[model samples]
Target: MASITGSSISSSFKLNQALNRVCCLKTPSISFKGISLSSSRLNQATRRLSITCAAKPETVNKVCDIVKKQLALSADTAVCGESKFAALGADSLDTVEIVMGLEEEFGISVEEDSAQNIATVQDAADLIEDLISKNA
Candidate 1:
């Protein structure tokens, strides 16, 4: 009977440790029966969790660079977030090649529908961020 109780305590401790690792971002306490476990310790093990992948500044810059390189645009030309590929003289073939370049650079496959929707530099950056987060 004593050994069984000891084993149960050990298992509970292990379970609490695992929970702490998963829920370390939030300071939430979980209660099991009458025992409470707090995951607010600064020294506890934690895993990073990214819920959303929004377009970051660096992603926008990289996308702009890719677009400029793919289209062979002049260095004097500016590619802003709202700058549409079509406005930048990108034809259907150019657009396809640009999408392929993005895929190769980011190591993520872009769906046909999603590829068609990428009009502006911001759109490509946002899609790339989402794909990267999903892959992560």
Candidate 2:
């Protein structure tokens, strides 16, 4: 679990950035908590829920940065732990490239099954940490 404190502003900013990435994909709508949210409504929801991160913030940050770079996202585009690769416009080939970048950056080799399961930035970060500890 991640803590919510004085960094709420930063957290919210990252969340909004991530949400914006998804919105740019032109999704018609998404349902969460039994509520169907249009693009505009999802933006509102993002502002309300940006106080937590499930993994180490540093690891998450690195993953987010790598993803953004791999996808050629603009500087203003924010990538957060919850940001999914598919939502960021990464296809199968792009995903493979992202995994390669991560392997080089983290000095860890992700097994085929593990790589297949990394659908989100958080997923990649979590796997990196797990591999790091196991190797150490």
Candidate 3:
């Protein structure tokens, strides 16, 4: 999508089609056939704007473990970074316990205000990393 402002019409058309596929089909696959990227400032700006900061795999795994344990989920249950606490049958007290477990495991303290903002495993992982880095 960063090359959306490319110099080729075919590229733009393909990007538009890919965007439609993502929006309509709810798929992560995007095809960039015949896309010619131009070395333009606008394209560079678009690239910067689209950049995302994802959680580290180890951090996500640890968070997943804590979340699964707190929720008492079985080994067969699939818990990923995207798994939300509420969706995993965790209430407010359960979320607090999960946060406590994360804090103890990571040796990082999470603020009450910050704890309230965590919903998904990725959120908890990101916060743990942030807190650990800040403390270090």
Name the runs in model 3 displaced over 4 angstroms.
Answer: 1-53
TM-score of candidate 1 on Cα atoms, chains taken together: 0.60
Which digits, one per residue and each the tens of the lDDT, describe model 1 over residues 57-133?
68878888999999999886767555678767899899999999999998999999999999878789899999999
TM-score on alpha carbons, each prediction: 0.60, 0.64, 0.62
Clashes of 2: 0
Judge candidate 3 at residue 103 and give its lDDT.
86
lDDT of 3 by residue, 30-61 (tens): 32444443335434543443344366778888
Which is superior by TM-score, 1 or 3?
3
**lDDT score, residue 93, model 1?**
98
Highest TM-score: give the candidate number: 2
lDDT of each: 0.71, 0.74, 0.70
Best lDDT among the predictions, by candidate number: 2
